[model samples]
Target: MGSEQLFGSIPPNWEYKTLGKACAEGGGDIQTGPFGSQLHASDYVPVGIPSIMPQNIGDNRIIEDGIARVSLEDAQRLSRYRVRVGDIVYSRRGDVEKRALVRNHEDGWLCGTGCLRVRVGEKNVDSRYASYYLGHPNVREWIVRHAHGATMPNLNTSILAACPFLVPPLPEQRAIAHILGTLDDKIELNRKQNETLEAMARALFKAWFVDFEPVRAVGAQFIAPDIAPDSMDTRNPGAINRAPTHWPPHILDLFPDRLVDSELGEIPEGWEVVALGELVEAVKGRSYKSEELVESETALVTLKSFARGGGYRSDGLKPFAGTYKAEQVVHPGEVVIACTDVTQAAEVIGRPAIVRSSTRYRRLVASLDTLIVRPKDFRITKAFLYFLGGTEAFVSHTYAHTTGTTVLHLGRDAVPSFTFAKPPAQLVQKFDALAAPVLERIQATEQESETLAQLRDTLLPKLISGELRIKDAEAFLKGRGL
Candidate 1:
């Protein structure tokens, strides 16, 4: 059924028309990428014009990482399918509802084989509004329902042209777009800030634990076994030959003066190698039936909650059944370790995500396929444990012991036994004091973004359908001080 058929009543003073009519007055046309004969796999290059494929369409932006790019000449040969900065690209097949706006970075790139592009005139029809309209939940579902393909869903230009689109006046369109855009801009800002904060935390972790920079500052040096020192420093007790003999008292106080050999090479004298189990243990999650779950604020944190790096995925949250034990609850700042992963050849089976606070009223708990890793004692901070799970040794161990032919699984017992070097208590405390805030700031910003996203979702449909006027939406936002 068409969007018009899906709903009987239309908002007052608003008219429902096909997308073809609105796009007909635009400066840019709707089209799909070059077919098989026009492009080939061999044309792709490591560094050149990027080919925007189905995978590049993130929620509302272009995701180019790991995407294939082609040489400048190849891109020119297929220039007819080229996209501009304001074009809204969609997946032509597999997932017809997915869309992404081509920003400055994606300008002049080829819309790859599995995608479609729609561009509109900024004067007659606001391009941002057009893009936002197509991305709206109702429009996406309408497209999905109207799309053709028995085994695999597909979309063509004809079906797209007939999409039912609700349009307000050009000025009203811009106002509505502005209202939604403001919310998205704030969310994007928070997301970027969180990324920077997490990166800084990881860099600090590497400097303190892996590189031993603080210990090296206090006259301790590691001479590779094959190389000899230039001269002997007889005055300094801890310094090896040719090492710096003098150091400030404050720098000296931060690290151990002595070094000793261990399985992980020479660590500080008092530090000892301990099993992961001794410091932290995995508390397995509960299983929930499909029918028991409901869409609400409370979510069940599953393996999907794990982000690419060390934080939780905002979209990975799932609704809960409102029944769970206290032990199953995963609060903010706690770490969630993935116990299962893709059963393919490679192994990253045990990825970690530090739980984040979503809303003031919402609660999260671990579900099946996740293991809530709780520190045995307060000695190791949650932030420290999160990064520790991501280290080289820990990852290697996970890959070495993983079982199952297709659905690879990491044994819960192995988590506690995984061995790693434990830094001195004072150093750990200092590291926590430094790195914990970075992670917390990320959590705070992420929570704020979630609230902004909710507001956007609420205002978008009302604004688009003409149920809420521009002045009213503006007043609503103003009242909330958004």
Candidate 2:
């Protein structure tokens, strides 16, 4: 009969309004994604435009790193439910509280089945503010109450439209949104930067090791006929005249003149195929009792610490009060493999999360269920080793060695037995030189994002409820050098 008692009391200037009233007419504003019957599981493809489903809707963000997607044609067929930048989307059924704002990169992504989209069109309400408001504890309670179905709860368009929102003036609303959005924007930026850095490192790895791009460069030069009798440009591997602006002459110099065949495959003349265990070692985590856990500081990292099955989640850790061994303790830029698999369909058993360090917490110990993966020496950088943990060979090896029925467990003891092609020493050093800094930058960005997220979460409820004045928030931001 009445709106949920969110924020206790609304400011004198603010008023309550239904979500439907906050949207503009025509389309784009409020709608459910394509119905279940419209898009089948078979419609998903290995690569295409990201099809946003419930799994993609993370806490305050949409994570599609490992999400299922559909072909562009299918996305177009369901264009009416397409989500654009600035739109707010929610999980339509189970976990109805899950919500995420559509960012620029997510523009034109099809709003897949089991989701709801809300594009706030009201003059006074900020879209970001509305998105956050929808996730506010009070609004979540309202949605939970209205949500039907006992076995599997569900939400629909009618229910979402009827949801109430507490409104504020445009200026104040924008201020609240700006303060929070600043943090969200930085967090988003860090995520994108990490993705770029990882992509660059992966591409480089594949080029140098798998496809042997450098070898191709040298091979092309050797196989080509001499244009001008004898002397040729020695600096360029891919070209005879001169090297491309992007290709550094120093990297070209590292490529070997000849190639040789090995049991693993074709390798550079002097390179060898080595077991992965020889390059890096996995250190098992220490056990802790529930009674030993404290309510503060960094705790043991579980598989849940892996966001969307790959990304490291700094906030996902719980506090622990027990002591741990040096090997079990993880530091910044370290990778920990999940030894325990808890997914319903045995999804990510041996998945690894790059342990993130922050000023907000002390040491983070790996759980008994995780294995701290460390490079044997400077021969291989931690970044390179972390990337290796994601390679197909590593994943397949882990999946094959896994045991148990209901709860799958990767054989932590046999990590070293897994083998992979070893690159030349100079190439490995070159990779570390180029890739380590990118990884370091990623760790730094992740640390900043985590800190900003904590600040944003702390300020949210109070600021939106008008307990914290806008002027004070601006002063707070200024003090933080925002």
Candidate 3:
């Protein structure tokens, strides 16, 4: 298809010009990030001003996870490379088509090496509109085709500047941005809310199971001098504590007042150390060849499905063409654990994630890199096991069982051999009563965000190219109460 037909019809009065002209007219500048020599690896600090590297650039948003940082002095030295609000940042080499718009929170972050910063000052163009336009499939394809290097596509300032840019009137530009930005804003709000909900669930799990806070509260009421409620710091394996909440008389009665010794450590009075295998069965997933991975409705939850820390990443799914047993098909809310990790730091091996429902796929199966860990014993819930897998102690145990030099692989005994103090069936039920709703809410919110993202992605290209007019798009959103 020709460029014009591929990109869609440019509406009347829309300015078709080079991106360089748009930047020049807007009093903006396109510049490269700091080079390696200018900012050395040794300059990075544990915590300071964030430096936006290529990896940090996501789908028009900067991913904060695993992002690098630099000291104030270093940031000051690289002030010119500091990104401003509404600026667009792109990866200079790999994934050259991806870009992230700098939001207010990311303002003043250094545009680190292997990145290009596009600053469109207030004048003839809207940076948000430009960002959405660049995300067009046609534009992305053009960038990939024009990028230098056969093995590793690379992008420079000139290459980006020479790209086509379609500029509507300033008011129209703002309107298009508002239409798309509203959907994105809601998705972002859902994401932040999910984080809060997850934190709440994790806190509850730690208090009940790991810290034994409820039992400690009971002991405190009885004035057991040996059991100090404040001594939670020493007893907790993670050594991190959320502020203890005042337990109701009924809730306090659920836990035993005294503590007793166990094989793992000093657990609550009635709790006993139990092997994970006794509570859950680890079912290995289907192993398939690369040729079997084709564009289809069937998706496999590969290692990428597990977030680096411990969470589900929908983008990690691979369309599968192979078949497997009916039992291998994992449904939403099921627990899956990564059995392999290619990261040099072993960040993902043994991590657990709950499967999420997909809008685009009909079925999801676990890949060989992951194992479906289902609760065999009714006393424990999937929510409990998921949090248990995320605990520092459990992760440490699994890490010890891992064997590999470059690519870590979880041992067959990694999940089954691991052990933890099992709470009473009553306590497990009580915990589930409190945690299940929160988890459900999280899943619902995530599903809503996924739908919103799909809607946004669908509307983006059409709106950018003027195939779908602004008023019609507004009407569609209004009809849905968006």
Candidate 4:
């Protein structure tokens, strides 16, 4: 489809005009602000004010979390750098094309040195339209081509002011923005809903299993003293002698009232914390030196093969030999943890996965970067261990213990010293059972999100290139009822 056909059937009367011609004469201004040298960690206070940086600027939106804060004193000193509503902020260096439109809530936001804030003239253009125009594929390509600096690319004020654009009528610009924004809104809602579901599942797991409240109640009921005012024998004398109601006092008293502190953190009663080495063997897989890695019917598991919540994805897999055997394999239910790359801390670091299927590797090797855990005792369930690894406690301790100057690595020797609480075998089994469904749902949601994201990505280029028209998009969306 042609641009006109896709944008609209009966085209809105729009003009092709340069951005410079559309803006107020001498109206556009691009300026840089103070360096980080002027900013101090002490000057930052949480919940005070939002500080905008290049990192905050995404493709067309801003990320607010972990945003730096400036004190009232610093804010007054950097008053000239304060961003107003409707202003467009661009990354001056590093990634020249990255930009974000200042929203209503960003009126009082302050920016850093690496960012260039653009305030448009109010003569002939709408800021919203200009933001969309700048974000268009053709406009971004122009910006990238003109960006300067050999080592780190950048867009200067002159380059930005001179950038070309298709100045569609203000109304049409608004309509396009509205359409894209609606999709973005829906995506955000899905993300938030998924987060809530994940949080609820985690909370339930903590309450029933990690906290041992359910098992504790059962233990109290089963192991009550034979002669006491509130003994189970007296209160429920009829059921006291039953097999199901009988439990050893030692088992009931396995867990204590309060948890003890270890190097890792506070753990549940009766649970013993040990180093990662104590639980499993750590080894790096062999490097496939051949340029062309062959694909076979047998699956070859790599670091990228294992997704965060989704089990294993074979779409990106390479070929392997038929001779590959089980000895050089990762079996179902084995725990795999990423040991290197602390920079991705809390991403998948220290996260464990129970191999749901068998995978083959070259040279009888597992991935060098992943540390596989083989549970020494049945007392600690693999599911329980996976959840434990997913926790902040595990990540923080693992990060602290990791050693390396260039790339942080989890030394095999250090794994055995890592400590954690050891809950009883029966309680662990109960926790494993409780966490199974929650984890399964998480995996399912992740897979669904992946599919949706792939659909969006595939449609993006076609939609932007005029290869696919709005009618086509409408028909596609209608077909899917999306």
**Candidate number achieving the greatest TM-score relative to the actual structure:** 3
Q: Which portions of model 1 miss their true places by more than 4 Å?
A: 1-15, 34-46, 64-68, 92-95, 121-123, 148-153, 220-252, 257-261, 295-298, 322-325, 343-349, 360-362, 399-408, 411-414
| 304-331 per-residue lDDT for model 1 (tens digits) | 6765434577677788866888899888
Task: Give TM per candidate.
Answer: 0.83, 0.81, 0.91, 0.66
Off by over 4 Å in 3: 1-6, 222-245
Native RMSD of candidate 1 (Å): 7.5
Candidate 4, residue 339: the lDDT equals 61
Q: Put the candidates in TM-score order, highest first.
A: 3, 1, 2, 4
* lDDT (10s digit) by residue, model 2, range 1-482: 23545667668998777777667531336888888799998999999989888878887788776777899899888888888777888887778887999888899998888888888864656778888788777788888888998877798877877888777888888888888888787888777767755665666676666666666667665332222111122222223233232334566678775678888677777777888778787888878788877766758886667765565877667788888787788887788887777545455667667887756677788887778888888777776777777777777788788888778888855567777777777778777776677677778878888788788878888887888878899899889988
Tens-place lDDT per residue, model 4, 1-482, is 01212122223455444555555442756666566687766678876668887767864667675677887778888898888877888888877787888888788788766788777666556676567667666667778877897888887777776665455455545545554555555656555555554454454445443555434445455333221111222122232234243334444454455555665455655567655556555544434544435555544445555444323443324455544334446665566766655353234444555554323322323455566666677766666777676666566676676777756776555455566656667766655654565555545554555555555545654544445556677677668766
List the global CA lDDT of all models: 0.74, 0.75, 0.85, 0.58
Best by lDDT: 3
lDDT of 3 by residue, 1-482 (tens): 12233455578888677777788888898999999999999999999999999868878999898889999999999999999998999999979999999999999999999999988778999999999999998889988998999999999998888888888899999999999999999999888877766776787688778988778778876332222223223222232235334666677788998788878778998788889999998888999999999999999999889876789888889999899988889999999999998655477788899999988899999999989999987788988888899899989999899988878889999999998999888878877776677678888988999899889999999898888999999999999999
Higher TM-score: candidate 2 or 4?
Answer: 2
State how far residue 434 of model 2 sits from its true place (Å): 3.1
Considering lDDT, where higher is better, how would the candidates rank from best to worst? Answer: 3, 2, 1, 4
RMSD of every prediction = 7.5, 5.9, 5.0, 9.5
State model 3's lDDT: 0.85
